[model samples]
Target chain A: MTRYLLRRVWYMLITLFIIATFSFFLMKILPGSPLNAEDKLSEEQKEIILEKYGLNDPIPVQYAKYLGGLVKGDLGVSFKFDNTPVTAILFDRIGPSALLGFQALVVGSILGIFLGLMASIFRNSPIDFSSTIIAVIGTSIPSFVFAGLLQYVFAVKLGWFPVALWGEFEHTILPTIALAIHPMATAARFTRTEMVEVLHSNYIITARAKGVSESGIILKHGLRNALIPLITVLGPMAVGLMTGSMVIEQIFAIPGIGEQFVTSVMVNDYPTIMGTTLLFAFGFIVIILIIDLLYGLIDPRIRLAGGK
Target chain B: MSKLLEVKDLKVSFNTYNGEVHAVRGVTFDLNKGETLAIVGESGSGKSVTSNAIMRLLPEPHGFIKEGQILLEGVDLAKKTSKEMQKIRGKDISMVFQDPMSSLNPTMKIGNQIMEGLIKHQNMNKQEARKTALELLTLVGIPRPDVRINQYPHQFSGGMRQRVVVAIALACNPKILIADEPTTALDVTIQAQILELMKSIQQKTDSAIIFITHDLGVVANVADRVAVMYAGKIVEIGTVDDIFYNPKHPYTWGLIGSMPTLDSTDEELFAIPGSPPNMLTPPVGDAFAPRNQFALEIDTVMEPPMFKVSDTHYAATWLLHEDAPKIEPPAAVKHRMQGFAQTGTKGGGKR
Candidate 1:
């Protein structure tokens, strides 16, 4: 197991390196420069600014410099954020994004799983029908649309919370709901499909024949088996949630990594854009690793297979 | 022996999108303590449905006991609520299914699967259940109970898994163990071992077994009494010797004739022509009439009642009628019967 994990970590490093290289080169190919917005500055002044930041260095020299900084765990300074260190700015913006993401994920997963379980247990009933309807609507509609509707209903008309601006708990509510719906739907849909299949399996019949209580059968045998596939879908969904939703952050005026990413791209802030992309890639790879480990824990077949 | 279970005119049906499928139409039988009664039939013959109905494990919202009584120790199990059945299942009645590959839960350890019933029905504490589970593993001939108990179902081979399945079914020492083609998924050698294990276990516990299988060879090996199902009804039922030696119903004759015997020199084996009738619109009168080569004219118009051949034998066929003309069984079937009589040995009945 230790060897397997160490090998996976090694592969992860290669994957991250490939991603870092691609994103860096992809930014260089974009049409505009970081100084495009500085129209009021004279040509000579712009050159001085470029020289100071070493932007006049040839592509290979600049690339070499970037790699040097990366090896030392430095993400360089943001081009447009008052020259702030990219890491410090990222650390600052990450709090609200992580908080909102975590809240949405926890709430969404719990509600979605509950909905799915109910649908499967009471199959073909009104509850099942309604749960299906909820899943369809949840997945079909975009998060931003839900954000707009939530703001209109709760903030504009009902006055249940503030309209926008991030401050109190109430301010966090609408955006979280918006971001939560998609995952909730995805989880519900996946859980229902997997559970429905599992509940009808021969083992379930064996469980019933063993005179296991209905609840016991559903929770222990049914849910445990169903969870394997659910985790597959939920793992990627979780990474997407954890990184923050850009449109949602913008609409809610929440100072999050997603909004910072958008602003960085608009101003051609290379370091901040690279930092955010790398953060998302890192989260995705780690989540995939965690998912692999979780599979071994949940299913012994996989666990033993990996041993050899 | 005292009667352990009595299934009287038990009818089962499933509601499908096309229509209601009358899977089991008025089947009746009784099982005595310490005996294995094998219900033998081809696919869609309703033998499995009858066993599932007894345990109240039929698929819900569709498959159900349409009518009749499943009397377990004089108490009607057919009338028991789902909640009530929960207490009776795994404790009083347990079942081993056809496919051992899928019968045991993959996520669970062999020990926990065995312990589940003990912990639930017998109310055994964790430690006690664990001990009993180990004993069950040992009883089923699985080596190293200590290590095997902690292992999951996938670790075990097909035969080993079936043994684990048997261990789980036997955990609570159920009075009635319904083995629904338990050896169907096993190889011939492993099938014999599982049969032996079950027989030895029955001897120790005195649990009555309702063994359901389509294999006559298996029936002869394990069943004291055999009930031959055709469509949704039992067309012939008697001691194992009676079904094999003096099968009266044409369907039963067809079944025996189809099996390949060890010494048979025939160019081709006999196969019952045509498939079973669709349950969506079950044919009138005898369901097996179309397929029975020796089917009488009355068989198509009127269903034959179970005529008593002896105190322990009965058959549902017009051929047994006093007024009907005497017609002997086919030459091949007759030869097989005589072969068994002289040798005092059973045919392999290999498909």
Candidate 2:
């Protein structure tokens, strides 16, 4: 297992390398020079600015320097943000984004699994019908629209919450819901389908024949098997939650990595853009690896014999 | 012999989209204490359904016992509430299913799976249950029970998993054990071992067993009384010797004739003609009439009542009527019966 994990980590590093190389060069290839806004200054001043940021160097030389700095754990300085190290900026913003993402995931997963189990247990009943309706509504409405509507009703109309900010736990309510709604719906739908399928499995009939209670058959047998498929979805869902949160963060004026990343892109802040994009890619890859490891633990067939 | 379980005119049906499907029609039988009764039938012959109905384990919204009295030790089991039935299941009765691998939960340790009943029904604590689980595993012939008990179902071989399932069924020491095709999924060698194990276990526990299967070989080895189900009802029921030699039902004759014997050099084994009737719109009269070559004219218009063949044997066939012509069994079946008699394996109908 250790060897297998080591192989996976090596593969992940190679993937990261490809992503970093592409994003770095892709940013360079985009129209509009980083020094375009320097028209307000003299040509000599512009040249000085270009020299300071190493823009005058050839692309390959700059790429080599960037790669060296990356190896040394130096992400250089943000061009638009008063020359602060891109890593520092990222660290500052990541806390809120991580907290928000974590909150969304925990809340979404708990509710999804609960409603999914309920939907399966009371299949073809009002509970299932209502859950399907809620999932449809949750998935159909855009996160930004939901965020805007939630802010208007809960914050502006009724004055129950602060409209836009990320100061306290309370401030995260609307944006987190906006970010979580769709993925929560998707997870719930998947869980319901998988649980229903597991409940109908031949093993469940055997369990029942063994005189196991209905609840015992479901909680102990059905849920564990159903969780395998649900676990696979969690990896991509986490990435989607973080990436999808950019819009919600912008709407709520939250100081999160998603917000910072978006701002960096509009102004072409090279260091910030590279750092955040790399961070996103890293987060996605690492979560997927953890999910793969979890699969081996949950299922003995997979653990004894590695994934086929 | 004292009765262990009795079913009176048990009828089970499924409400399908098209109409009601009579899965088990007027099936009735009795299991004696400490005796193995085999319910022999083809698939969908209502053998499994009858067993499931007795346990009240049938899937709802589709399967239901329409009319019946499943009496266990004089108590009508069909009348018991779900909660009341729960008390009886795994405590007074236990069942081992066909597929051993699927019978045990994949995620659970073998010890935990065995101990679940001990903890739930026997009221034993975790430590006590674990110790008993290990002992049960050892009794079932699992090697290194201490270490193996911690292992999950996937770690064990197919034969070993069947042993684990047996160990679980024996955990509660149920008075009545139902093994539905327990050896059907196993190879011949493993099947023999399991049959021997069940026989020995029965001797030790003295529990009545309802062994449901389609294998006559298995029935011959393990069954004391045989109940042959064709459609949803018992076509013939008698002592094992009577079923093999003096069988009265045509379905039983077909079943016995279909068996491949070591001495026989026939090109192809005899197969009963025509498929089983569709249960959706079940036949108006005898369900097996279409497939029985010896079926009389009355067999097509009316269902036959169980006619007494002996003090302990009975068969449902128009041919068994007193006025009906006496017909002889096929030469092959008669030859096998004569061989069986020559071997002196036929004991009088007394245990």
Candidate 3:
């Protein structure tokens, strides 16, 4: 297992390196300047600024310098953020996004599995139909749209909570719900389809023949098998939620990495853009690795394969 | 032997999009302690439905027992609530399903799969159940029980997996073990081994078994008695000797004739002509009439009642009627009948 993890981590490093290199060059190729101080500063002043940040060097030289800095764990400084280290800025923004994303994931998976399980148990009934409708609405409509409606109904009309801000537990609920709907819906649909099939599988009949209580058969035998497919989707879903919360964060005024990522991209903050992109890529890869590891833990068949 | 299970006029049906599918229509049989009663038929002959109904494991809101009673030691099991049946299922009556590849839960450890019933119905603690599970694996002839117990179902071969399934069903030492085509999905050689295992296990446990299969070869090997079903009903039931020798029903004759004995030189194997009637619009009289070559005029108009051939034999056919012509079985069928003694002796000697 340790060997497997070490190999995966090695692959992760190689992947991050490729992504870092690609994004750096991609940013350099874009038709814009990071320091767009046209007409505002004298040529000497602009030259000084450019030279200070080493942007005046040849593209290959700059690329070599960036790689040198990356190897030393330095992501350079954000040009638009008054020389703040890209890493520090990202670290500051990640906490809120991480908390919100984690909350959304936990809430979504639990509620989704519960709803899906109920829908499957009482299949062809109103509950099943309603969950299907819920899944459709959750996936079809955007989170920002849901965010606006929630703000209108609960915050503006009802005066139940703050309209837009990130501070206490109360403020987290609205954004979390908005971000959670898609994952919750995805998990629900997958869980329902998989659980329905698992419940009808030959093993479940074997369980019933073994005198397992109805709930026991459904929970222990049916749900465990159903969860394998659900877990497969969870990796991409989680990363999507974390990175996809940019619009939601903007609407709610939540200071998260997603909003920073958007701003950094718009202003051509070279270090910030590359840093955030690398971070998202790193997160996605890590999540996928974790999900792969989780598969081994849940299923012994995979565990043996992973062991070798 | 004392009677263990009795089914009287049991009818099962499934609700589908098209209409109600009368899967099992008025099937009745009785099982004695320490005996294996084989229910034989082609696909969709209601054999499996009958077994599932006995276990009360039929798919709900669709397939269900529509009528009659399932008596276990004189208690009406057909009337038992699902909750009540749950208690009786693994403790008193357990089932071994076909398709070992799919029967065992793929995600579970073999030991835990066997131990589940021991823990649930027998109320054994984890340690005791574990020990019992190991013993069951060993009993079913699984080598290295200690190691194999921790392994998942996918690690085992199909025959080994079926042994694990048998272990799970035998965990509580159920009085009535319903094996639903248990060897149907196995290799021919593996099928023999599994049958041998089941018989050995049965001799040790003395559990009455309801063996459902379409293989006459398997029937001759394992069964004490045979019940042949057609469409959704049992058309003939008798001692293994009676059905293989003095078989009265044309369907039974077809079934026996269809099987190729060791010395049969025939190139084209016999097949019972015509397909079974669709249950959605089941015919008015005999469901097998269209398929039976010996079918009489009255067979198309009215169903034949179970006519007693001897104390231990009964067949549902108009040929057994007093006024009906005494027609002989087909030449191929009579050939199989003549060769039954050799196969029967071989099967008994092997056991």
Candidate 4:
């Protein structure tokens, strides 16, 4: 198992290298540069700025410098934010986004899975119908719309939560709900489909014939199998949530990496973009790794099949 | 022996989009304590449906007992609430199904699967359950029960997994056991071993078994009584010897003849002509009339009542009526019956 994990980690490193290389080249190839795009700077002033950030160096030399800096945990200075070190700016913003992402993930997953299971169990009933309707609306409508509706209803009309901004736990509630809605709905829909399929499986029928209680059958036999397929969606789904949260974070003025990442992108701030993009890619790879490990833990068949 | 289970005019139907498919139409049979009654039929003949109905384990909202009484020891199981059925299932009755790979939960340890019924129905605590689970694994001939108990179902081979499933069904020592084609998914040699294992287990526990199968070959020593089902009804039912040696219904004759016996030297194997009648709109008279070459005119017009053939044998066929012309069984069947009587491999049915 450790060997398997180590192998995945090796693969992740290679992936990050490829991503770092491409993003760097893509930034260079674009018609603008951080220094070149500054219209007010004179030719000599632009040259000085370019020299300071190694922009005057050849493309290969710059690429080599970038690679060396990456090895030492450096991501250059952010031109978009008063020439701040990209790493320092990202570190400062990581906590808020992580906090928001973590809460949204936990809340959305638990609630969505619970609701989906209910829909599956009480299938065709009123509760099942309503949860399905909620799930459909959740999947069909975009998160930004949900954010607006939530702000309009909960913030403007009810005055339940503060309209926008992040820091206070209360402030995080509305944005989290908006960010969480899509995942929660997606989770619900997937869980319902998978749970219904699992419930109809032979082993579930065996459990029922074994005289297992309704709750026991649904929980132990049915739910475990149902949850296996959910893992596949969750890894990419987490990545999507992180990237998707940039909009939510911006809308709510969450002061997270997402806010920094977007501002950097608009100004063509290559280093900050590279740093943030790498973080997301790393998170995506690690999340997928964890999910793969979880598959083996949940089902020995997966492990054994891989072993063979 | 006391009557362990009785089904009176039990009819099961599936409400499909087309219409109500009469799966089991007014099938009646009784299982005595310690006896093995094999319900033999082709697929969709309602053999499995009948067994599932008895346990109230039929697929919900559609598959259900349309009309019948599934009486367990004189207490009507059909009248019992689903909650009550829960108590009866695994405690008073248990089931071992087809497909060992599927019958046991894949994620669960073999020991835990066996112990699930024990913990729930027998009220065994965790420790007690674990111990019983180990013992059950051992009982079912699983090697290294201690180690085996910790392993998941996938670790075991198909035959070994089936042994675990049987152990699970036998966990609470239910009075009645329903084995729905338990050996159908197994290899031929493995099939014999499972059947043998079940028979020995039955001897030890004395649980009345309703063994459902399509293979008549498996019925010889395993079954005490055999019911031949066709178009959702039992066309003939008798002691194993009666069915094997003196089968009265043409359908039963066809079933036996279709099987390749040791003495079957003929190059071209006999097959029953035509497929089973569709149960959507069951035939007006005898459901098997279309397939039976010896089918009388009355068989097409009206369903034949169960005619007494002997003390223990009964057949639903107009040929058994006194007024009907005396038409003997096929030449191959009569010869085989005589050969079986002389060999005495199957107990002679008053030869």
Candidate 5:
């Protein structure tokens, strides 16, 4: 098990290194200046500005210098925003987006599992049919569009809550629902599919024949086996929501790292972009690793088979 | 031995998109304590359906008991609500199914599955159930019960897994243990071993077993009584001696003649001609009439009632009717029966 974990961490480091190298070159290739003070600075002053950040060095030398700084946990500085450290900017803005994404993740995944389990248990009934339809609509629409619809229905028509912004619980609810709909739907659909298959399995029949109650069978046997495939999707779904929250943040006008990321990209802020890419990639890699371990926990057969 | 279970004119059907399939049509039997009643038939002849109906384990809203009384210790199970049935199951009656590879919960420890019934039905606490689970594993011929109890289903081999399943079924000492083709999915060697194990275990518990299977060879090893089924009904039922020594139903004769004996030296093994009739629209007459060579004219229009051969034997065929032709069973059956009678009894099966 430790070997499995060690191998995953090794892969994570390699993935981060590749993303860092690729993003560094990709940023250099774009036709824009990170330091936009060329007009105000004399030629010598501009040279000083470029030399201070090692932009005047050859690409390889700059790349080597950046790697050297990365080793020391210095993610460089943002050019578009008053030359602030990339780590500082990230640390400042991480809270709001993480909270919103986490909120959406909890709401969407919980609801989806409930709906999927319901659909699978009472299969072909009206509840199953309607939940399936809802899941379809959720998967088809983008989060922004979903946000707009939620806003329209709750904010404009019903006058139940605030339309946008983030502070009070009411303000976060609309955006959270919008962000969660797709995952909730994905989870519902996948859970339904997997739960249906597991429920029909021969073991389930044996459980019923042994006179285990229906709820006990569904919970202990049916849901546990069903969650394996569901686990595969959950990791990616959370990362997608965390990164996907950028567009959502802009629409709802929430102050979050998502807005910082959007502005950094628009203005060609290399350090901020590199930092954001590495952070999100790191999040994804770690989540996938956790999911791999969860597989062993849920099904001992997986670990035993793999060990053998 | 007192009667343990009784089924009175049980009928089961499955409602499908194509319409209702009358799977088991008015099958009746009684099981006595300390006995094994083997239900034998070709596939789709309702052997499995009849067993599942007794357990009430048939899939719902589609397959159900159309009409019947499943009287366990004189209580009508058919009239009980599902909540009440849950209490009856696993305590009064437990079942072992075919396909051992798929019958056990993969995520659960084999020990827990065996313990579940003891905890639920026998009212044992976790620690007590755990101890009994180990004892059950040992009783079913599983080696190293303490170590094996902690292992999952996939950790065990196919035959070993079946033994574990059997251990689970026998845990609570059910009044009747219904095993639906428990060895059909196993290897031939494993099939014999499992039957041997079941016979040995049967002596230890008073639980009357209803062993459902298609293999007559297996029936000889484990069954005290045999019921040969065709088109969802019992065509012949009698003590092992009566069915094997003086078999009368044409279907039963066909079954016996088609069997591959160790001593028989036939160039081609006889196969029962034609498939079982589709149960979607079952025929009005004896369901086996079309396939029977000696089928009388009346056999096409009317179903024959069970005819008594002896106090302990019965067969559902017009050939047993007085005034009908005194035709003997086919030559192969007479030859096999004569050979079997000379040998005295099946070797190494009786406890």
Candidate 6:
């Protein structure tokens, strides 16, 4: 197990290196200049600005410098946000996005599992049909569209909640729902498929033959086996929720790293963009690692089969 | 002997997109107390279906007992609700299936699986059920019962898993234990061990066992009476001696002839000529007529009713009619039958 984990971590490091290198070059090649804006500096002033942010330096030298700063835990300073250090800005706003994303994940998984189970149990019934339709809608529509529709209904029309901005628990609702919609739908559909397959499995038939009640057979045997597939999606779903919250956060006017990320990208704030991208990538990599470990824990067969 | 279980006119069918597939058609049998009745058939012969129908464990939305009366000690199980059936299932009647590796839950500990029925039906507390489960593991001849109890199903070998299944089945001391191809998935050595364990356990519990399998070799050792099924119906049923030595049905003769005996000199074993009839639109007459070598003209035209060969023997075949020709069995089968009869007593095989 230790060897397996060490190997996985090594692979993660290599993956991170590749991601960092690709993003660095890709961002450099993007059309707009980080310093040059429609309403801003003249040519010489832009040259000075570019020099300050290492944009005037060769791409290799700048990448090395970026890597050096990254090693020192200093993500440099943002050019678009009055020269604020990227780390300081991100640290301040990360709490709301993390909280919103976390809530979304928990809510989505629980509700998705419930709906999926209901759909499987009452398969071919109206509940299953409607749940399937809802899942389809949730997955098909983009998060931004769902967020806009939710804002219109709950905030603009219903007047039940605030239009935007995070304050208390109530402020967390819309953003979380927006973030949760796709994952919840995905989890439900996956759970339904996995559960249906498990319910028809020979083991479940044996359990039923053993005189186990229908509910007992489903909960104890069916769900336990179904968890393997369900756990596989949790890693990507979590990362998606965290990074994908950008548009939803912007829509709700919430102060989250996702919103910071979108603005940084728009104005070509190099330091903030690099910092946020690295953070999102790091978060995703770590979550996937943890999920892989969890796979071994939940199903011993995976562990016994010797981790893939 | 008082009848412990009686299955009357049991019919099971599956509703598919094409139509209703009649899996088990008008099958009937009776089990007395402390008896071992083996239902023998090839694959897809409805042996398992008849057993599942009695337990009401057939998969829904596709399979259902179209017509049947499964009476346990004179109580009609068909009329019972699901809840009522649950009450009777583990406590009164239990079943062990083929492929113990798949039967036992991979995630659950063997002890927990055994104790589940004990606690649910026997009203035993956790501590008591745990103790009883350990005792059962030991009873099923599993070595190191104490250490083995905490281990999951995957930790045990195939044979050990079957023992665990047996332990769970016997947890509530059920009056009837239905073992559906229990040894089919195991190796030869493990098969012998499991069959021996079942026979020993049956002696201790005095329970009627409904053993379903395709192997006549297994029936020779474990069964008291044998029911030979073809298609969806029992074509022959009799005491082990009657079926083996004085076999009357053509299907029975084919089955016995097909079996590879240790002393046989033939290079190739005999096999029944054709595949089983399609259940989608089953034949109006005898289902096995197309496959029977000794088939008569009436065999294709009309379904034959079961004819009593003796007080303990019965077979369904047009050849068993009073005016039918006295046809002799194959030479090899006759020699084997003669050998078996000379060596064995009235009750030679153990349950």
RMSD of each: 1.6, 2.5, 1.5, 2.2, 2.2, 2.6
Query: Per-residue alpha-carbon lDDT of model 5 for B100-138, expressed as tens digits?
Result: 999999999999999888888888999999999999998
Tens-place lDDT per residue, model 1, B145-224, is 99999999988999999999999999999999999999998998999999989999999999999999998888888889
In model 4, how large is the Cα lDDT of residue B6? 86
Worst 10 residues of 2 chain A by lDDT: A299-308
Model 5 per-residue lDDT tens digits across residues A1-308: 56656777898899999989998899899887865734777889878878887789999999998898898999999887788999999998888888888899899989999999999989999999999999999999888998888889999999898998878988888889999999899999999999999998999988887789999999988999999998899888788887899999998888888888999988777789999988998889889878877888899877733344
Candidate 6 clashes: the total is 0
Interface RMSD of each: 0.6, 1.5, 0.8, 0.9, 0.8, 1.3
lDDT winner, 1 or 4? 1
Q: Highest lDDT: give the candidate number.
A: 3
Regions of candidate 2 where Cα sits further than 4 Å from its true position = A1-8, A304-308, B342-351
Name the better of 1 and 6 by lDDT.
1
DockQ for each numbered candidate:
0.90, 0.63, 0.87, 0.79, 0.77, 0.60
Tens digits of per-residue lDDT, candidate 3, B244-347, equal 88999989988887887667665455788888889987898888888888889999999999999999999999999999999999888887777776555337
The CAPRI class of candidate 2 is medium
Consecutive 10-residue window with the lowest summed lDDT within model 6 chain A? A299-308
Q: On a 0 to 1 TM-score scale, where does candidate 5 land against the true structure?
A: 0.96
The docking quality of candidate 4, as DockQ, is 0.79
Deviation in angstroms for A180 in model 4?
0.9
User: Which stretches of model 3 miss by more than 4 angstroms?
Assistant: A304-308, B343-351
Comparing only chain B with the true structure, the TM-scores of all models are 0.97, 0.96, 0.97, 0.96, 0.96, 0.96
Per-residue lDDT tens digits for candidate 2, residues A1-308, read 66777888999989888888999999899997766766688899888888999999999999999989988888899999999999999989989888888889888888888888899999999999999887888789888998999999999999988999889889988788877888788778988999999898767776676678888988998999888888898778888787788988899999999899898888888988999888899998999888877877888777734343
Of the two candidates 1 and 6, the one with more favorable TM-score, higher being better, is: 1
TM-score per candidate: 0.98, 0.96, 0.98, 0.97, 0.96, 0.95
Clashing pairs in 2: none
Candidate 6's residue-wise lDDT over A191-245, tens digit each? 9999999897777876776678989998998898898888788778898887888
Pairs of residues at least 3 apart in sequence or in different chains that clash in candidate 5: none
Better of 4 and 6 by DockQ: 4
